[model samples]
Target: MHLVPLIECAGKGFPDGFYEFKNCDSFKLLKEAREKQFVSYLNIGATWKPWHLYRSTLPFTPMSSPFHKLYGHLSDPVRIFTISGEFTGHRIPLSEDLLNARMVMEAKLHNLPEQVDRQYSSTSQSTASTTSLINIVDPETKDEVQFNDPDFRNGIVTCAALSLDGHHVALGFGSGVVELADIDHQHTISRFQLDPPNHPVWIEFVHGSHRVAAEDSEGNVTILSHDMTAANLGNLPSGPLPAVTRVSDNGLFIIRVPRNTDSSWYDSLTLVSILGDPHLQHLAPPSSNNFTPTSNPPILASEPSTSSSASIKSDAVLTIPHRRTLGFSPGAHYIGAFDGLSAFTWSTSSGELISSYRVTDFNLWIMNPAVPFTCSYRIPDPVSPRPTLSLTEGEAAHTHYSETHAGHNLDSSWIKCPFYVLLPSEEEWDELTMLDIHSSAAGRTPLFGTNGKRQRLPVSFNGKLEFIIPKEYEPVVFSGAKGLGAWYGDRVPFDPTFLYSPRSSKDGTRILLQGWQTAPIVVDLSQVI
Candidate 1:
């Protein structure tokens, strides 16, 4: 319950980046909730309006960035990135000026159906590679379609992720195209194609290797390799946000629900193991005790479910190809700080970050076993400054401005991966055995120091952070930032609430509660984890 924000914040609960956060009754009420054990949360957004009635109607979204505390909106493409150890974030120019660009594109293409069809004619991966500048003159309407659109192409971001090192980001678009963006330089690096161009619902980067794992809505996965060798992961369980998985370190076995969906985006998980065999078992989320699979983990070189993060400034992007060429980019961008996620990390006694780990569902803890055996590629640096989100927009709404930075050790293949799928009890306050990555394993040698595998501890929290049930929703939720919509109790959700997600930092001390309507919130859970 000790809340130490990674950065400072203003009086109204807004972070330092926001221009002014002088007063907010809703934020105060949320603080009261934390003290009363009703809930614990801290608002991270600047108050859009100071009206007393805005609390209940604050806007929120479902889509968020991949590991860091960044959030995005499906309709409005603006995105923000929060510093580690807190929920307060500054707007990162992910889809910064997308609103204006979208408006322009709409004006240019809205009247020209033929031109629009020709331009977007084929969602096929074979279409001439897209770029920042689109210049096509239609003969029929004698109209021209030309502009500098970010790799996002103004499409809905189906999936995204930060590289292992935290210097880059890979974004999967509804256009069936994936783009690699640079965090340090602030530009897109390259683009990957998804065959049949279905909305890539899941995407990820294989740690220490050069591979991107991407899965479309129809469940088809493309293991995109920079070496031009791509593999098809076939189909996987398909659904909305966070239906993602990671590959094992060895190459075989996809561990679905490797870690229980620890955020609000998913409800009780049903463990379905595609063991790369004739027989597969479908198990439900365990009510009590850890649930182990009856069968050994299958080869993710074959297929795997989706899950994948990064806070480091050194992060890079993931990439791929279409058809039989093979590529991979698994994800659920889950849309929340944008909810920042905690990928496993290891540090030294002096508190210098030494090693970090990525997770895969394969039976064994291979930061991503499938990464080595299967084709992998380190997505190249962001190509150009084709703004997806314009700086103009990134600076709006009293948000903070952030300079893009990168970590120095992105190329390091260092890892401490655990390959177990321990189903957890969703009942709020229930205890679960979790690996304590913060407490390092000192025996590691060869420069790994304390940045190696550590012990597992039984941890618990003091809140009712359960999945939202629409049937239990109330029209008038509480006025506080943490209260259920005008209502109270563990079940707190409504139509707009599901659009967002949440994640923790590498050490798991600060948990980011992501939302779009208002700004994100940070909760200090160091006391629990």
Candidate 2:
């Protein structure tokens, strides 16, 4: 496998830098993620405030499974219930794990229907917890937490996250204040401050664990207790301190984005203990982890481990081109990222670059069924695993969650949700090109030998699935007109700066797509996928 720096891959004259300063003083993405905590603050669009604010990528969360795991066969939409309330438009979830937890306190009478009690049984399946939130709040919920000034006051809310139970909300203020508030009672439960005034830019309640991972403005993470306090067990470390970090959906791992000393763009992605320093476990021995002779300007491993809370000591590093999105396959079997037209996958067990593939076809935006088109597109579902005799095993269609029963052998295989989908950037915005994730990334291919071959592919570099906006509802640039109304046979125009804005259902059956200037619509993936 031969890889080069993203800049070298681009040839001459690449423009723009990767780093940007995101502050709470004007960021709306943080504000929107917290709006549900304070129902009244969920503003839909641009406000009339004199000062303009940075519009956030909308907080459109896909619904998790609400039914018992036994009913895994139900179609994606049927297996769940919407977060019944003002957030209906956002399509939140009732969340299965929450249903199994004991009732903290008797739910408000209005929120829980009386009929639910009669339906409950010790031997029967669980639905009481789910029923307790039906029509929980008005579609137009009453205002609660109001900002001093909509422009900047609201922006002071640096970041927000909801507990797995969806009963608590943790908000980080610009003043380095972290508040843990109860969503059910609309009141503050606890508040704390970070030393030396570090502002949190992102916060997430780690699922399946009693920890809160807060990434500060400078990209340093502080692990807090479930009650929002400095705690004993900390996060698994992934980067040298001060590297930008992103947590997984399951909150089990962290991926660190450390910038290349040579360039402004990040040349590699280090998954912190999940993407860290001394306390973190670094992959042992350079010989154990091997990188295929890919990537131009061969990266030299930088070590001499530093000792800091945010520092990491890595023995093996798989440096690739500039990457943005990071994901893990189920059980974190494989880790990879999309850098430009290339896809790179690594083995978690060996910490080696197992396979890499570059897309040969660029115009893979439409889906044709009679006989599938694009090499990236994985059409027609097979009933069972069929044998295939192809050498390009690295470039097969990725395994969609719906297909594998999401890892059938695993316990609770019916409802596993891993963050593995990839959305590459493109010039057009009306359509979404999905570099879908596969379940297994366990394959091997010989190095670029003299057998006359192209680059080696990932254990799996399945093609792609592309869906466009229904012709009836195209995205508008200004006053909502369809495709710039051209008679010269021009193609439909799109918002080039899509900012990775689409949302997919937990089951991977439906992807909700809403353009900047258009109403929301869903791509029914059940048919094609």
- Candidate 1 lDDT score at position 121: 49
Misplaced by over 4 Å in model 1 are 1-154, 240-242, 246-254, 258-529
Q: Compose the digit string of candidate 1's lDDT tens values, residues 279-357.
A: 1222222112132212212211211100011011122111110010111111210010001111222111111122222
Cα deviation in Å at residue 39, candidate 1?
12
List the lowest-lDDT window of 10 residues for candidate 2: 443-452
Q: Which stretches of candidate 2 lie over 4 Å from their true place?
A: 1-155, 162-168, 182-190, 227-246, 258-268, 273-324, 347-352, 359-529
RMSD (Cα, Å) for all candidates, in order, is 21.6, 23.2
Q: If scored against the real structure, what TM-score would every candidate get?
A: 0.32, 0.37
Q: What is the clash count for each candidate, in the order shown?
A: 99, 28
Residue lDDT tens for model 2, 1-529: 1111221332332235311423432222222223312111111221221111111111122223121121223223211112232211322322232222112111322232333343333344865464453433211111111112122222244455545344455656545666665444444565566554555655655543345666664545666664544632233322222233444444455555443344312234454332212122232221222322223323332221111111221322223221123454443444544332344444443445534434223122111111212233322221221232121231132232233223223212211211122223453223422223111110110000000011111111123312222222222111112112211100111111111222232333443322221112333333434
